[model samples]
Target: MTYFRSMLPMTSEEMVFEAVRKCLDDAGLDAGDVDAVVCGSAPDAFDGYHHKGLVAVEPSGAFAKPFSRVFVGGGTGVGVTISGWWHIASGLFDKVLVVAWEKMSHPYPHAQPLFRSIFEPILEQPLGPNLIWIFALEMRRYMERHRLDKELIARVAVKNKANAMDHPYAQLGAKITVDDVLKSPVLVWPVHRLDISPTSDGAVALLFASEHEAKKITDTPVWVDGVGACLDSQYWTNRDLSYPYYVYLAAQQAYKMAGITNPLKEIDVFEPYDPFTYKELHHLDALLGKPGLAPQLLKEGQLERDGDHPTSPSGGLLGVGNPIAAAGLMKVAELYWQLSGRAGKRQVPNAYVGVAQAWGDLMQVGQVVVCRA
Candidate 1:
């Protein structure tokens, strides 16, 4: 028997419901067949609402069912999916439904100000820093140490947006260039408006079934061969900004579970969190346990869709729009599509296994999933 998985976009509760309906339709199953539901999202401040899990229950078909909600900032979506997979793999449930959503547009002062709360209020806030500041600082450090130019960073934006052109749920799609990114209004030093993912309102749903149920439903079931999640101390000031220690730890755990001794050679594709261009490179280094290769890959155009190891083939958060929790789930969805041979034109050639990772909340949390066709 094998395990099966599916994913759909999250626009609203209604849209989420419709996507779940489609997933059930595609799987030839119904809401009654599900054993449990796991929902995830970021803080209420970003959504301008509280108890979002309750609001999602009825629409997501979790009503009257065993349901749970988990939050870990941007890692919430992957955290929920990992939870759902565990429920089925633990001999408790045969099927699980995972839902992740974010409505950043609902907030009054925009989501930017709300993210400031994630930092240490006494120290970081007094310094007049926001989320972009951290990313900008990370970008600056990466460029200075690695000798990368702004043009290379802009290429990430261009490639991701171009990839988004084929994504049905993509929010920003354009034939952009490096010049477009450099010329875009600067939000923070070294971080331009185009470098950031927009505040979006969306959700994504995924269905996972146990080996017994999966084999009965489809001949080719994408296996959840590996999953790893870890958190570092919330004290951001104590950590090194040059590299993400949490991401490395999480990758080490997931790679071991997947029996992958060499990630660069064994893994077919990658979907690292690209909330910022530097993040893609940051995660790649952590995932591979070597930061030195990233610059070479970028210089040789190996990180593009047509490259040796395609990263962010779904355009990632940068191109697809960042709906927080939903963005991570979207990367998982891309892995599912690629593994199932349904990615259409965006498909990576002969991709047998893919790794999707999400880093969240001051680079303190890391979630990694390894899926196989």
Candidate 2:
């Protein structure tokens, strides 16, 4: 799950095919049973390919089948699930192969310049912006608004990486302290070098099926109860960073569709995208339909692997390694195993309902999926 020197030798397409093959083998299905193929990849710039989907399809088992690729910045992981839902929901297909992979190692070490290149040349490019720079500004804003200490904010990184020690597929899993985070050099004021998820090369695959086919495929099937996605304006400077408005709206849409009035009590586990430590808190506040709950809850040990609400129980991107497109899908897969009581060492108790969320595009897009066992 983590990136290493050996992984860089393989191409992105090869990674996709290998993961998909494993998926097929585990599910007792073959390529012929696949009604369609859905490719989940990050931006073209990351892989250094213009048409990554078409480039990845033949090796991805979509040689002559109905094929489509979904990319929504970092949310492409969960976006793959949302895209595959349509094929099954529309009654046009019984099975869909959803594959998510990212080769972030291509532009390793200093990906900031590549990140800066994606901004609008006329407006934002003039500022020499990178995601870390922008994230630090938001982090400072959130801290100032809450009048909180930096030590409290740094707890997220410590907790996630520590929890990753139990994750079999973790990259940076280890026992670290809050002091370690404080001693880390400040990359941009509030953001520390250790507080960010490392860029990784990884892939994940999931098979989606209609209700009828799901029953026949496996005795235990995790159902997609609700799904919601929202895109907000690109006015990053104009809006307040204290909360993510679009993320809240997306969670609301999902909760409403799932017919659950109370999320904290109803949903047993949560896996929110956390490319940055502060991002875990930002997304949690929005997902919970409130502000400033994450820090306080975290201090009380409520966000732990055995707490009332377990956030990022699978170590998330912070610990398990962030291969963007594959990260969110890995969360969904974790929820499936958790709810089924098959997560092995990291399983939560009685996790019947769960939610996994992803954010992308200059903090403008929110994608959510509510699942049940």
Candidate 3:
């Protein structure tokens, strides 16, 4: 038995408190019944407050209760949810509520400057590099190495935004075309404005409970069968720029835990992180354990929502706004909705198992989750 509920809040403190309140309300369980709480958010520089975990405690209602906070850049949101599952699965807790949020509206130098903290201070930062530079570089390498053109990448943007047309929470929904993306103003060499996820302010929360507790909560429960997360060495320069090794390791661990040997055939849908268009393809190759097939698949339109293995049915970061932590959890939330038959127009036909993944932090961190209906 599995049942989960989520909340999206308006403020950082309120994000935590409202998530707890919504979980309790949706499941008809009192706050006292919760046995543990897990929280996640991006760095303090982005939030303009240090030790944000401490500030989140009171709002999370974790006073004297088992609680923990995990951070791994954009992967932190999914990391927190996986942490909550561990507590319940390990028999340490009967119920766990996971909360994730990011408030970019708090006066700060547009996320680019704050993103510098993820780079090596003595080396990378001196070059005045930001997140977009890395993504643009990756995109260029991906294009050159694979002999793929920008039009294909632009098509990804078009498809994802078109899919987001129905997503209520999406901030960048538009009926765009490959030409539109190609013509969009370039921010970095090959990366254009349309290719990037917009900085957003949002929060997301999820409730997880043991088998016994889940049965009593809701009729439709989506099981959290597998969860995995991993980080590569922070030394980004040491690794190959084209492929993401962390995503491969994370997906492998999650697939093994879920008894999934062939992700392309076993999983019904995908929600790969797409802060940049190329990431979605990069993660797809990793998720399928076949780096050679990504370019072929993209050329054939296999990654589209109507394709054999539909990806980003919730519009992903490319379509939906990127609230950092919340953005990753939004993918998980999309899986929950789809598996429960709640996704109205965006629902995939006969979806059984769904996989959602998030990659971030100097391109060294990956978080993955597998859900079953």
TM-score of each: 0.95, 0.96, 0.94
Q: Local distance difference test, per candidate? A: 0.81, 0.84, 0.81
lDDT of 3 by residue, 288-316 (tens): 88774666777788877789888898888
| RMSD, one per candidate, in order | 3.8, 1.7, 3.3
- Model 1 TM-score is 0.95
Clashing pairs in 2: none
Once superposed on the true structure, which residue ranges of model 1 sit more than 4 Å away at CA? Answer: 1-12
Candidate 1 minimal-lDDT segment of 10 residues: 1-10
Candidate 2: stretches off by over 4 Å: 1-7
lDDT of 2 by residue, 286-365 (tens): 88887888778888989998988899988888898888889888888888888878888888888899999998877788
Model 1, position 248: C-alpha lDDT score: 84
**Candidate number with the higher lDDT (2 or 3):** 2
The global Cα lDDT (0 to 1) of model 2 is 0.84
Q: Score candidate 1 by lDDT.
A: 0.81
Which numbered prediction scores highest in TM-score against the true structure? Answer: 2
lDDT leader: 2
| Tens digit of per-residue lDDT, candidate 1, span 18-84 | 6567777778888888888898888877655667777778767888999998888888868887888
